[model samples]
Target chain A: MKSYFVLIFVAVFMPVAMLAYSIVPKRLRGYVLLVFSYAFLMIMSGRPVVYLVAATLITYVTGLTMGHFQARRDAQLAEVKKGKKAIKEACKRTNRWVMVAGILLNLGMLFALNYLGFFAQVGSGLLSLFGIDKTFEPPLWIAPMGISFYTLMAVSYLVDVYRETVKPDRNLGRLALYLSFFPHIMEGPIARYSEIAQGTWEGNPINRQNLYTGFMRIAVGFAKKLIVADRLNLFVDPVFDDFSLVNGGIIALAAVLYTIQLYCDFSGCMDVAIGLGCIFNVSYPENFRQPFFSLTTSEFWQRWHITLGSWFKDYVYYPVSLSKRVKRLTTMARKRFGNKYGPLLVSSIALFCVWFLNGLWHGAGSQYLFFGMYYFVLIWLGGLIDPLARSLATKYGIDRDSKPYRLMRRVRTLLFVFVGELFFRANDLPSGLAMFKRIFTHFSLETILNGKIFNIGMDPADFIIAGIFIALVFARDYAYEHDHNLLAMISGKNAVIRWAAWIAIVMAVVIFGAYGHGYIPVDPMYAQF
Target chain B: MRDQIIEILEDINPDADYETCTTLIDDRYLDSLSMVSLVAELEDTFDITIPAVEVTANNFNSVDAITKLVERLVEEDED
Candidate 1:
């Protein structure tokens, strides 16, 4: 598998790497980059070259239609510039067709790649009742690599262009590169065209400073991934894979470990990506934001997956809220339903759309969808009671921003996030729900102490190491939030202290990092995006 | 129309823009999210729907510009 990945990586990355180093025109560089990104992606999907062709075609057509729409509008606007308002009404209609077409094209790939199997299952199940099954399975089930990540990027790109947040790329090649940039092709921090357009198109040179930073980050990431996260998984997988064999205490610990494993694995991938981008002289947005330190799930969102969370908030939630239909509904609700439930009913629809898409982005499964809605319901409920919470705090003469309230909120958010991850980590939907129910049913602490799954590997010392790691996480989060400048401050101290901090982080990974033989190499979870 | 638009702009960004339109939407003085919120509030305050097309810089450039756009939209709806 490692060799296969190496072969695929060389096949996909070597050309792009060369292009990055090539003295060719910067703008045309995006063309080579786009071709290789998709080609590499298709080749990685093995024999499913058709899926790649289909996604590329869909995205290509969508961008062309969008650009065409923009051009037509520019022409009409110029004609109107000569002071002719007579045919402007017709121009508006034409522009609307373009917007509709853009949306259709962007959404077309989403349905084709992600939802086809889901709809088939539902349709076949419905048909079976009448013995009218029509079989539909495309033989090339090698699932389009990076379909989920790039699809969102494409949708947001078109949406951004339509909204004029950014200009419509007239060149289809630049647009394709924006969608399929290889380092970001698989799991992404989901770069927006607006964010990277100037940097990606203009150019940044590869300096030793950037090179060292990139490699250092990759090393740190690999350490977190191999030594810290994967090693801990030896204890976690059994507890989660078959919870029937474990007790509540064990399950609870597994949930927390899974959280750590996910963070290490995911943020580690971001480190690698950001590092890779560093080598290319582009800076991608940081996805994880010391999430555990968040005072509310809302705040947690602001910290964790900041790009994706904001993407939904900006494109979906805010737009739906301001839409004419929603405003009208809100007005009607306000007059009839009063302030009591007016905003709730109106925002719930918008919130549900964001959450539903959020869930579906994780996987092509109901469980992931449930995981997203899980936070949606929790956050919405929290939002609903905000006024009441403030008033109650006032009556009690307590500060809402005080440490205690913040601590309580943080605890609440952690619990909320943890429960959502429980569902997300489960093998399947039913198993996830059943495992959840087992939390209430089979309550015992003995399983954790008895080492039910330690037979797989992991010692008492490993648990302690995990605990120490978790503590370090919290400490680092607090420092980050408070802007402790601990490292900078300490580096100012005796050289002994500064170098010690560096050595500690490095040596810990070197000695304890999980790698080599009988160990499952866990890929970055976010990479599946 | 100028005064009404000024009132809305004041609510969103009070420190600047008492004169010519400031390209409020295009300049992104109010970010996309906050701009949407502002739009919803303005529609409620002034009784109009900012059409998707009307959301461009040609109309939303400044207080006076937005006020004129809103008046035009409202008049068209009334018709």
Candidate 2:
């Protein structure tokens, strides 16, 4: 199930159609792109094509209806501006039902599809009380690939349109393309209308620069996926699969390895999406900026899943922070409890809920819930108590910004991130909690040096590979962070050198990548999004 | 208007000043989160809807740049 051919077909066709879209008349661009989107969906889904079509239809109808309503409102607003003033709120009230309906329809489809397992258990429990002990499970749990993803796109579009941040797409065809942009259908950087409405449907000619960059990026992404992510998975699978046999030392090592693997896996897919966007000459936000180099959990979050964080901030944090209740609570806390601690305390509770919600967004499990709260607690405690530590350090006359303090903070941050990730990577809450216990109580350094983990599925050679790759990753970041012109340096070289470097990168993937080695090639994890 | 914009910028990024901070969007001095807040503030302060097209790097470069951008957008609406 490579599903590889769909990508091959798509790589050839998408940009050509986009070029065709550029020359096409205004009326047909939307329709042509829409057909392409559906065709793209059909090829990817192969056997179960109807679900994506239905999703596309649902979004199309909702967008059209929203557009229709928006057109009516705009007309009304224009009239009012033309001396036929009427209260807009009354008109808004009249159309509010449709908006509410659109939100529910999109959200309902998402939960029903993604959370079928959760509902099945609940349904089974309710029936068991009356002796209906038998269970009902879906014969096919074929969640439309990217159902979660497209569902988010639909919601974001509907919500943005409702907020009038963007006007609804009057044409249904453009709306379908927006919902089912093939590159982003499975995993996402979840482009907003404001991000891409101009280029995505604006009928821009696909330029060579965009095409070259796009495939180059996709090539890099494929290399990361087949080489780095799958290669690392060889080390992680055996360790997690048999936790009892592995010592705490190996478990910790595995967690650290898995953490990087997860990042590489997730970010590698993002490169694919961004590359796809590049081909279309549409800009998608960069979702990863070397997250492994992040110095703190908060910094790690800012770098990792950048879009998800921003999404939560926009959709959840701003609204909650601006709400009258939160505002009043903060104001009162500042006034009554003193400005130093009060508002900070109240915001943490809100922050906790937001993190917890963010965690649960990944999946519906107690483990995710714990993963969310773990951040809530750590970030909260860090915010509230960090000042005291800083103050004490000041009293002792140790420069807080001194190298030792910085090193300590860095170490503490790694521990915080590692432990939080322990819970995140764990199979369940109890498992996560048990792992944490073992790390603290039963920690040992001997096993790592003894090569216990290396003997599993990963060879000693794998460690050498990981070491070289990790060093390169760090060097890449160092160049980026320090603003060294590595890209320019390579490109500035003589033609032969540049070409050689490019070919070497390409050849590395063709030769050493984990695929075609008689081992099952694992898909990038973020594809589940 | 430029002074008011500068005051707002100073609240968010204290190192900012009108002349040095005008190329805000291009320089990536203000992130998207701050961009949203800046938009909200400009909307309330100027009583205008800053169209999406006006949020480009050129128009949102500095306090003076943003004020001029806002002035043009609002004037267009007035016409």
Candidate 3:
């Protein structure tokens, strides 16, 4: 059910919907997208559509209520000029209650569906530790697909309305479409209400150029998913499944491969989603910007999962950092320490909460939590070292911007990222520790030469093909990093060149892509989160 | 007011030329960290609260905008 074939079917169905949309009234086009989006959700998620609808209804009501309170407060302020403060206070209190209610309800639904079982197990484990053993068999709840994604979208939408950044969409259906757009329902760019509301409402007709670019983008996504990521997965899954059996070299190789597989899989899905949106003239935000090229763990995060990073920064980081208590803490620290250390202390506290929640957001696992802390420490250390490193560079007459220094930093960042991903992909915290120990203690060149690397699922030919595809991926990303407009460049070429390029992609996917009768489609990695 | 704002900006990051640079946020002259510090300085100096919603590039891109925001917050407090 998670196959690219189904995605291809949806791809075909969307264009057909647009063809039908062309004949309808211009105003009706938006509803076409809405109808199609819901139909897609129902078809894909089945009973979980209930969760989707419930989330939609909750946000829709919250938005409308907030808007109502805002309007009434403005009128009251205008009429009762003497008690403006009282009126504003009342309105603010009422609006805050509505917003809190909305956030809690949506987050509550997510918790019950996603985290309740994990918590129940934790509770039972705690009981056992206290010699009061209790077996709590958590309810078997069928959580909806994209609950994580849509709930965040819902929260962002409500917050945006509360802030008056954008007016609440009066039309429920358009709002519904914004929440449950099919392309984004898998793994979102977590699009903002302001970013996509008007465009989603308008649903512009499919232009010829958009169609060409969109389909091409989808082709590139398919090649990455099938030709690169899925193949790498063939190698990564087995090694990680039984890390104890593999040699250290193989395990280390597995970490790099897992990183590659994850990047391609997640960003590849983004490509498909963004490309699909383009066909309907709906543009989602970019999620990745050559993250592997980042010179620091912090920069890597900014480039990777660009939407989620910014979402946390805006909703969690900024608010917490600017809160009265944290601001007070900043002043206290500044009085005690100097300017640099005070702000750093404040930012460190905020970063702790962000990373803690970020870890919990990924999953309830200890390893996932460790993964969050791992990067937190790295980024915090990098911040602490910034001034010292600059001074050292100046004293040594070393150019920080020069190629050698930049290259060294990139390598250092990759090393940090690889170790973090190793933990992230491990089965458990203990397993992660064991494999990491093996990597340092038992690693040797003979591990690869012992003919054991090929024993994992992928053969030599698969490795060669995956290697070539990965190289091409890096090359394409490198071009993009240099600001090369690859899609536009291809489009501007002659017909033979364009057709050949498209055909080559299709042929590569068909020939080498990991699919057919025997393969079970590995669900897109970030979708489960 | 502008001179005071520039002084605060320079006190935070002496490298930034807040005198002429308009795209402080856009061009990375004042990143999120500095922006937070700037907001805190302005609030403390002007005796006004700058809400999180008003902390956008439009309100902090230049000394003029920062002065206007402080003035508006002051007017609101008086109101």
Candidate 4:
């Protein structure tokens, strides 16, 4: 009940839900999904499920209202040739207001539930700075499960409707199911209305091909979670929790391990989510695209948590950067600085907003903000330096696209990512800074030289197991990066090979998974956010 | 108009074969920063408002796509 990986959910709840969904008539299948979605939400967050309902209702009403105005506008346009411009302008203005109101309402709820307390604490701290003794008692709010995921989806849907990219769903139940489909409710690919809503509503029966592919994908997710991520957690958690006890070398190693742990854990969960969606004949968008293979920080964001990045790009970045005021600034700056640096200067304003909100969206924490700013600075600097770098390479007769150069860039990007994740995983901004400082100031190889590395939570055997699995995962990602779809390749193979692959995955998880005796199963990492 | 659009693309990022490359965005030839510069240049050059909604792959993925988008927006501006 707590997470998708739990035995109760995996063994009991999913089987029952799938059975019920399969047995239900085609006409009632969507309702069945709606019912289970709500039931899952209720079990997870109880009364807070009301917030999801409120969001769905607000989105539904907003869409219909805009639709109504659009209809009227079209009718009037059809009836008249003169004054059509004025009529269209009037309707556009009204719909804009309606869309803005809907967006604000949805975002307002999210802010109250997730961010109010953090902001209040900051407010109180500022007050005390001026010799004020009074403190504002922030409300304790239990956010509904997947509030972050769903709210973004809700806003995307609303905006898409306003943009006429997606027609508003008049069917409340369909919209409800789109928002609350149990698989994506927890950690989402932040699916758009246009992406999977129709397929979801169609409720196509679970054909054998889909079922096999879905189960195979789920098995891969389980293998990733059980074997690699959980095992690494044993070493990663304690180091982060008690970072001060370890030297810089160990701290550095821990950071690298932590980044791997996080990728596996988060992407593994996404695999399960998408697999479940596949079982139900809905294809959730891919969230991770071999993020480790990216060569630049900007490219890394494009690859990692892809939906979230694209969400910000479509909703926040493009809008802010292309707004009238920013566009005017861009024009002015471009005139002054020329084509390369001018628009970039203005675009930085929009980039700053994206990173600032991106940080806050993770959680109301200073470290998260710092993490966002870290990437922002790196990306902006990269943009600023790219032209110079390219010119220098040309002047020096260096091949920027050569494998060595690409490898160097990938390593550099990974180093940057490791540091960012250090801040992201640290207790706070100060702790992150302290740990980072130690990496350079208190550097040492004594931990490895003295055989102390193995003593810190993970033995040599643990390392071997984790290393083997990590390599396997890396190979799979490498194949994917090269356009080799492992699943498809397997699916197209003979029964013996397919069955062997499945059995190997299952046997690996059952045998080498970091559970049972002393291992603590890590909760789905991205679920908290 | 098409030639002017190609000039803008060349100025933005001359690495690609704009005449034949249709995967400018898809292949990362036109990164986000490049997209921003391209949009601003196109707007200033054409004297048309390119709203954020029009900044999709279908509109900016190639020389032909960018030419069509600018022409369409220019037409809309006239209307």
Candidate 5:
């Protein structure tokens, strides 16, 4: 019941849902999905389901209102050739206000639920800083599960409609279903309306190929979550929870392991979500693309949690960077600083907004803020030095595209990611800083070499098992990086080979999955976000 | 107009072969900053506003696409 990874979910809930979906007529299958989606949300978050309903209603009304204005504009334009521009502008103005109000109302609900306490504390701290003796108790509110994910989808839906990229759906059920689809409602690939709305609403019969592919993918997810991510939690959690007990070497190892744990846990969940989507004939966008292979922090963002990044890019980056005022500033700066740095200056301003929110979007914690700013600074610095780096490479007769150079860049990017994730995983900002300080100030080879590492929750056997699975994952990612599709290759094989592959994965999870005695099952980490 | 757009693109990023290359944004030949500059140059050169919605890959992915977008925007402006 906690997540799709649970045995009851896999064995009972999914099978029942799939059975119900299949039994229903095709015309009614979409309704089946909607009913199940709402049931899932209600089971997960209870009364907070009202938040989702409110958001859906607001988004639906906003989209329809925008559509109405757009229709009016077109009609007015046809009638008046002389002042058509004025009419168009007037309609655009009205739609823009409607869109803004819609966005703010949804965001305002999200802010009240997820961020009110955090911001209240921040405001109180500012008051005390100014010698005013005022403190407010932070309110405790139960946010709807997947509120963050669904709210973003709702905003994107409204924005897309306002932009005239997609027509407003008159079917309230379809819009609600898109926002509340069970598989991605917990932790999303954050699908856009334009991308998967129709296919999801179609409720196509679960085809044979899709069933096989979806099951195979879900099995891979189980193997990853059970084998690698959960096993590492034994070591990662202890070190992070009580970092002062360990030396710097252990702290550093914890950082790397936590980063791996996060990737496996989150991306494993994505595999399950996307796989479930496949079974239902809905194609969710990918959330990760071998992010460790990225050569820069910017590229890293593009590869990791790709939907969130693109959301910010389309909704935040483009709008802010290309706004009339910013454009005027860019023009003036380009005239002064030239093409290379002028737009960079303005883009950095927008990037700051993207990262700042990106961080807060993860949580209201200051560490999340630091995590966002860490990438913002690194990406900005990367852009700032890019021309210089290129010129230097040219001067030294070095090919940036050469294998060695690219490898080096990837390694550097990975290191930067590890540090960023270290802050991300820390208990809080100060603890994160303290652990980071330990890495350099108190690091000791003796701790790792003296077998002290084994005493911290994970034994030698645990390490070996986790390492083997991690290597398997790396090989899978490696093949994917080179454009080789492992699933496709397996699928293309004869039935015997495919079944064997599938059985092997299921068995791997059964044997190696970290569960039962002496182990605590970690919740899907991103679900907390 | 096509030549002018190509000239603007080349000025932004000379490495691309604007004549036939069509995946400028997809391939990231014109990265975000370059796109910003390209939009500014196109607007300045053609006296057409390049709205953020119009800055999609389909509009800026190729010289022909950019020319088409610019021409349409120009006509809209005149209208």
Candidate 6:
């Protein structure tokens, strides 16, 4: 079947669904969401809906099982006249086993579906090196769309239930709706159970203001995707497809363009998701927060794909760092290396694990792995030099928070992020390295200024249009960075001006958007993950 | 016991008035790292095992809540 994801479909589906959603009774609105979501999934994913249902079932049952054991243990403890420790220990052991089984089952399915092929290829190649020739073919696996997202969400669900931070929802449908919620299924803010579950079930009646805001938000998202990201893809595809032929300037320009493309594409998708949720009065957590304004690599991560980083931090980083083994290692390292560097030893090891998983979670590619390591090294180096930098600033009486210093730090962080995206966008690890080599070795100012950029599928006019849109995006982001809302500003204007502005945005997208003719639709970037 | 819990909170983050800050976790006065350290410290100082479930904000939102949680766990251990 031909893919049903066209611009026209999105334009129609959103309004129609919103209308239907508003017509439903308030209490039944949650089920309307479920029906809409599953319908969307069936249309988009088809057979792979099995994976979503299975993940929901396994996690749902696991949660109930864990909760049941916890209750039994509490009751048993109350009944016992003595030896509560023994009872508690036994319960802990059983719950730990159940948690392990739950995590392993879901993760195993994900690994088998996604990474099994990559591992098989590597394994067979290794075998050939030892004078044994055997061709091993991995089984064909059709992984469900959004497996990365829902799997991570499921793990968080189990962890939250296990930690008793939130009780397991006894209603399987609510849990199902949470996992399969259509707007966020493809690309997620990776919401926590405690954060969004109650609101999902509360099903607040649709409001007129929310409709106006949601439609405006969706229009802005379409403008970003259609006007900026897709148009830039024309140039980015050609340059990245054959990096060896391009000189330093073109590659550098392409790197910068790719970064813009990635941000607009991913964040634009988030806008649609969040805007769709707004219609139902379900405000999902934000995924992006003006990431380009970050002053450090750490701050960059905090602002970029915020949910994923927070998920990794809360679920992976904290657990690993606080575990008894890491605690013991911290003590030993402190004794051996002194207090200053000792704690870093534990942090570095845990950070390594976090990055390793972070890289793998992106996809089954070695380049993705390197992308993770690149940040890990940068963050670690930043940590190592932090005290020295602070001391020097203090000694020199320099205000590090001053405008110039902050600007300088932001520029440095921007370059770091651009370089990381260069690796991430490359075809493979070696090609990324070669591109880096060309960037430094084959530098030429004439190539960029003399109009070589216009030769790559896009004319000068295309660049100008894309450039204008990019500037608009930057201005809006800058305002947003200062916590100013442009939409709200528009709303405060007179009726004629406000209506004119909204009409102008919609018209500009239709007239200048990259879609209508000869435009190849570029899939949303993070949707692949 | 409340004083002891406040001392631990102050040791971790001295800026916030832990005794009266009922929305410590909600307002992000205490982040994940500080919370982890706080949990470890509470367990060590009170000689009570704080299960992962008790890490919720309901039990650690203020010194009073934390004191109550610790006392309950301690009493359970004695039983």
Q: List the residue pairs that clash in candidate 3.
A: none
User: Which residue segments of model 5 deviate by more than 4 Å?
Assistant: A46-48, B14-20
Clashes of each: 5, 3, 0, 0, 0, 1
Tens digit of per-residue lDDT, candidate 5, span A37-128? 88887766655478888999999999999999998888877887597777878988999999999999999999998999999899999999
Model 6 achieves a DockQ score of 0.20
For each candidate, the DockQ is 0.15, 0.11, 0.47, 0.88, 0.64, 0.20
> Which TM-score does chain B of candidate 6 obtain?
0.94
Candidate 1 per-residue lDDT, tens place, B4-54, comes to 667666755554556864766544454333344456666777777775435
lDDT of 2 by residue, A24-84 (tens): 8865665666676667667666655566667666666766676676678677777665533
Residue A359: error of model 4 in Å? 0.2
Give the lowest summed-lDDT range of ten residues in model 3 chain A: A1-10
Cα displacement (angstroms), candidate 1, residue A309, comes to 1.9
Best by TM-score: 4
Candidate 4 residues A424-483, lDDT tens each? 999899999999999988899898899888877888899999999999999999999999
Write out the backbone clash pairs for model 5: none
Candidate 6 local lDDT, residue A228: 93
lDDT of 1 by residue, A440-490 (tens): 788787755677545645777666776676576567667877878554465
lDDT of 4: 0.90
Q: Chain A structural similarity (TM-score) per candidate?
A: 0.86, 0.86, 0.96, 0.98, 0.99, 0.95
Can you write out model 3's per-residue Cα lDDT over A1-529, one digit (the tens) per residue? 4533355554676667777677778798888877777777666666548888899999999999999999999988878758889998898889989999999999999999988888898899999998997988879997778889999999999988888888987899889989988789878989998888777778577787888888888889888888888888888998899988877888899999999999999998898888888888888999999999998788888789988988887888788888889888877877777666667777788788888888878887888899989977887777668757877888999988799999999999999999999999999889999999999888876757876677787878889999899999999999998989798899998878877898899899899988776454777888778
Error of 1 at A441 (Å): 1.8
The better candidate by DockQ, 1 or 6, is 6
The number of the candidate with the highest DockQ is 4
Candidates in order have lDDT scores of 0.68, 0.68, 0.84, 0.90, 0.90, 0.81
Better of 3 and 5 by DockQ: 5
